[model samples]
Target: MELVFATHNRNKFKEIEAMLPDHISLLSLDDIGCTEDIAETADTIDGNAILKAEYVRHRYGYNCFADDTGLEVDALAGAPGVYSARYAGDQKDDKANVAKLLEQLKDKESRKAHFKTVIALNLKNNENLFTGICEGKIIEERRGEKGFGYDPVFVPNGYDRTFAEMEMKEKAEISHRGKAFKALIDYLSK
Candidate 1:
């Protein structure tokens, strides 16, 4: 089953492709000659995911899936929820986003946070949504250098190491996006 994953970010494409089974072939925007940047103008993660998926399907007439992830902090009242990608600016600088998040979380004790992912799949005019969450707390400073996008600052629940500190396989086992894609696979298999 070949499905286009509506994203220009190579990192996201790689991560998701690694998660998908061998029978499923994943294609990125680049793979299908879609150099255009799909706008994510929605106010919510779910909406943004849907928008991306719908955009690809409408323009290219392909079965596609798109995902939006957010880092919701209890201390900030879920700030940066829908703007995780552009939290620092529109450039989507991962380092700058992490810096801003750490600055906002400074001097706060509650540090409770969670990473949430919403995936929207457009298959033959039928759209489906799946969600996943990984609960954890924010560290005072960045820890490791493996993963991207606030991975250095987030320590998943029941784990001592941050996402950046974990291996790719380990992170995949517990990441919000991983869980969401797993659900997507289950839905597709059914």
Candidate 2:
């Protein structure tokens, strides 16, 4: 089957594509002539994911899927929730965002947080959504050099190191995005 992954970020594309079946021909926004930007004004992961997916499906008249992820820190009362991408500012600098998070939790002893992801599947006849989350604690200092976004500071529940510290395959097997996409895959496979 053919799927249009509604995202402009190559990292997202790579991560999702890596988990899909070989029989599926997945295309990114760029490959499908969808270079225009869309505002992510939604308040939740499911809303954002569905909004993006529906937008792409309607714009191209094709079946498409989209995902939205959020890193919620309990110390901040789920701060940077839906605004995870642009938490720092509109420019969305990764370093600055991480700096802001680190500073916010500087004095807090409860370093608990979780990564959640919502995947929206927009089919011609129906729309379906899948969600997943990984429970983990936030580290004071960033570690490792792999993965992207807030990976360096997020260590999965059972692991001692952050996502960036693990190999791509290992990370893919346990990452929040991985868990979410795997659920989506399971749903599709059925």
Candidate 3:
């Protein structure tokens, strides 16, 4: 089956593409020639995910799927929830965002956090939402050199290394995005 993955970020596109099964043929937004930025004006992950998926499905008349992820820190009371991408500023610098998170967490004893992902799938006959979450804690400092976003500062439960410290395969096995995409894959398989 052919489907459009509604995202402009090639990193996300590549990661997700690697996770998909062999029977599925996935195309990125660029692959389909949808270069226009789909505005994510939603206040929540569910809304944002659906917004992107709907845009591609309706505009291009193709079965499409989109995802939105957030790093919610318990100490910050779920701050940077919907604003995870631009947590630091409009520039959306990952380093700056991590620095801000670390600064806010400095001197705080409670470092609990979690990564959540929501996927919205738009098919010819139906649309649905899938969600996945990985419970973890925020580390004092960044670590490793792989992965992206807040991977360096997140340590999933029962693991000694951050996502950035692990290989792509290892991270994919445990990531929130992985879980959500797995659900989507299962649904499609059935």
lDDT of each: 0.94, 0.88, 0.93
TM-score of each: 0.98, 0.97, 0.98
How close is each model in CA RMSD to the real structure? 0.8, 0.9, 0.8
Tell me the TM-score of model 1: 0.98
lDDT of 3 by residue, 1-190 (tens): 9999999888888899999899999999998999898999999989999999999998999999999999999989998888999999988899999999999999889999999999999998389999999999999999999988999999999999999999888888999999999999999999
**What does candidate 2 score on TM?**
0.97
Candidate 1 minimal-lDDT segment of 10 residues: 8-17
CA lDDT, candidate 3, residue 16: 93
Give lDDT tens digits, candidate 2, residues 23-57.
78898989989889877878888899999998998
Q: List the residue pairs that clash in candidate 1.
A: none
Show the colliding residue pairs in model 3: none
Output the lDDT of residue 63, model 3: 98
Candidate 2 achieves a global lDDT of 0.88
TM-score (C-alpha, index-matched) for candidate 3: 0.98
